[model samples]
Target: MSFIRQNSKLVDEFWEKGIVESCPIYDMHGHMGEHYAIYFAAPNADEMVTLMRRANVAKLCFSHHFSLWATPHVGQAPALEAARKYPDILRFYCSINPHYPDQIKQDLAKVGEWIPYCVGLKFLPDYHKIPVSDPAYKPALDFAEALHLPILIHTWNGSPYDGPAVLRDVVPHYPHVTFMCAHCFNNNWTAAGELAKDYPNVYIELTSVPGTRGAIEKMVSICGSEKILYGTDMPWFDEHQGIGGVLAADISDDDIHNILHRNAEKILAPFL
Candidate 1:
């Protein structure tokens, strides 16, 4: 038997049954609603919850595509309704678009109304065409810091907006807020590892990282398991694919456990 199958019950259980009951997944990054540019197989709440059940996912924290792609008013409604309807399986991040300063202020003012369901804030700086460190994000960052909420930022390897360099400027300022670097600064593994090592409140999220062989193992080695989070970017990628990638990585079962759910649990404790 392989070392993983021998030492990790989760591996055997997942291999045989396709889901591990003992270690249910907590997908920290996800999206609801169809994208204007691309098609998604499971965009609606019902279909997503069904997939979550099949994958033994305990909870999924998501932002609506409309919120990111369309106006916040048009996008936040579906996310709110979905979380309201499926409280146990879903939580949402309030998407912030820096372009609409008035809307940003309006939304942040009403944040309390979305409480319990809106666990944190989501920033798509690359798409929004603004650097995360810009003053435009100040209100959202301030609110997140005050509430001690996690902020999921869509980071890429070389984007001027939400890349590692931009993150370096912003993460240090908000020491109280948890910054989940979605996609782990894609392809920039060294910088991602360094960010997690340097900032106690910063976490590297595994959205697109798993697709790169040896990335997860390298991250664990550099920053340890506690600073890494498991996120599928679901509807865009399947949960099983992400889970399989982590399971196949040459890391301890304990490391797998931390990436899959334990670390996420700790991040969500204050909100949920």
Candidate 2:
């Protein structure tokens, strides 16, 4: 208890001395639009912007909640509007419905028009209940690869829909498309680490992932911080948890900078 309390104080001091300001922090995974749950902050772009600004976030990459919950077109509106309003600090991802082949085609056709404005595509096979290897996903994946847009895939190890094992098959095939695995494959950091270790194009986003002692360190050791990105799954999860996890990790300042922002700059290079 004493050690835990003492470490907590040091973490507070780390931010008090302005250590987080050393580099621009970019939130690589977030959501915009209303979530019916009362526990979440009201879904509005202005509120989202305010939350990021308070956290010292220089930029945020997010998708619309509607897209993940309902359909692609319905969700893209809010996300696109927010990106247009705050082009400097906000960029969005286009979602596709694998069950609807025409929707996927329409979404991909319009994706080219959102370039520089839309940074990537967000795939939540877990929500859609589809496999990453589905035939419908290939066209969109191909389009993203051709344009060099990063593809953020929600991965939860052991799940039938999308998980590390699913990623293992899909990632290798799309070598040109940067696969940002959300949640570090969730509770399966070992598998996530191995995936990143093996694939140069594979990246990891630390959102709802466990921030236990030596977890971040192990990821850094395996991936070298070049492929690790900081994300807050915001409004649903607190940004401080993600930010403080990396800040308080037992790594060098350079590694901290890379995870906080440098790596995102590289990941989003095509859009920027």
Clash counts for the predictions, in order: 0, 0
Write out the backbone clash pairs for model 2.
Answer: none
> For residues 1-272, could you state the per-residue lDDT of candidate 1 as single tens digits?
74334666778778878788778899999998888778888989999999989999988999998877776458478788999999998999989989987777877777788887888999999999999989999999999999888999999999999999999988888999999999999888888988999999999999977757889988888999999999998888899888988888888888989999999999888667
lDDT of 1 at 130: 95
- Give me candidate 2's TM-score against the actual structure: 0.90
Residue 96, model 1, lDDT: 95
- Model 2 C-alpha lDDT per residue in residues 35-104, reported as the tens digit of each score: 7765666467788777777667888899888876777447467778889999988899887778777776
TM-score of each: 0.96, 0.90
**True-structure lDDT of candidate 1:** 0.88
RMSD of each: 1.6, 2.9
Badly placed stretches (over 4 Å) of model 2 are 1-14, 17-19, 72-75
Q: Report the number of the highest-lDDT candidate.
A: 1
Single out the weakest 10-residue window by summed lDDT for candidate 1.
1-10
